[model samples]
Target: MGLRMASGKLRQSFRIYEWLDSHKISVTSIAESIAITPSMVSHTIRGRKNNRRVLKKLVDLGCPQEFLSLPIDLEKQVAA
Candidate 1:
């Protein structure tokens, strides 16, 4: 079974992902800016991982605070 995520958080995650996409932000760039691995940033973006530092950096880069928080189930979203 896939991990479960709240509908609200799922939507928020998507919003954050979309915002990043529209702004041409890449996981590699985020990782470089925050001194973390690109995989960590990518996982965080996909809601498969949670890293406070990464989330903070994303907020610093203009992502809305409300749309960023905790981790969700990317697999479930994809399956749907």
Candidate 2:
């Protein structure tokens, strides 16, 4: 089976996308820098995929670490 998009956009993913846009960073550029396909980079940004190399490169390029990991639901955690 193929990977499918998440039903809802992840919080971290949205933040990362916004940060990339604000910084004028393009998925194509990141992909080229890492020798990966643009689709893979896009997928990673959208939370449909995970790639350590891509994540590392984003951080190296000044992306905030908070936007690179899954978001924790503090409310849910407190309730649990």
Candidate 3:
């Protein structure tokens, strides 16, 4: 619905980290699944990371496509 980044970088405001925290999903687990380093995941959770590959992998693992879009509204995210 907006001019979203083509790279699909994950943004902190989207609260994907909160969901992961609630589910007890560790950064290491995500890193392993995505073939990336844990530091990358940690940086992302801390809002200092942005990688298209990482975002793509996260999406494939069930992160909503909305998270990759601009002006995300957490209230509108579909339930997991």
Q: Give the best candidate by TM-score.
A: 2
What is the C-alpha local distance difference test score of candidate 1?
0.69
The TM-score, computed over Cα atoms with residue i paired to residue i, of candidate 3 is 0.55
Candidate achieving the largest lDDT: 2
Rank by lDDT (best first): 2, 1, 3
What is the C-alpha lDDT profile of model 3 across 4-68, one tens digit per residue?
A: 34322445434777667777877788889888898887665554655545655666667655554
Superposed by TM-score, candidate 2 places the C-alpha of residue 11 at a distance from the truth, in angstroms, of: 5.8
Query: Worst lDDT window (10 residues) for model 1?
Result: 70-79
Error of 1 at 76 (Å): 30
Better of 1 and 3 by TM-score: 1
Per-residue CA lDDT of model 2 for 1-80, tens digit only, reads: 43323422453877888999999999999999999999999887877776656776887788876666633332233236
The parts of candidate 1 lying over 4 Å away from their true place are 1-11, 70-80
Local accuracy of candidate 1 as per-residue lDDT tens digits, 1-80:
54345323443667887899999998889999989999988777766677667876786788875676533453233235
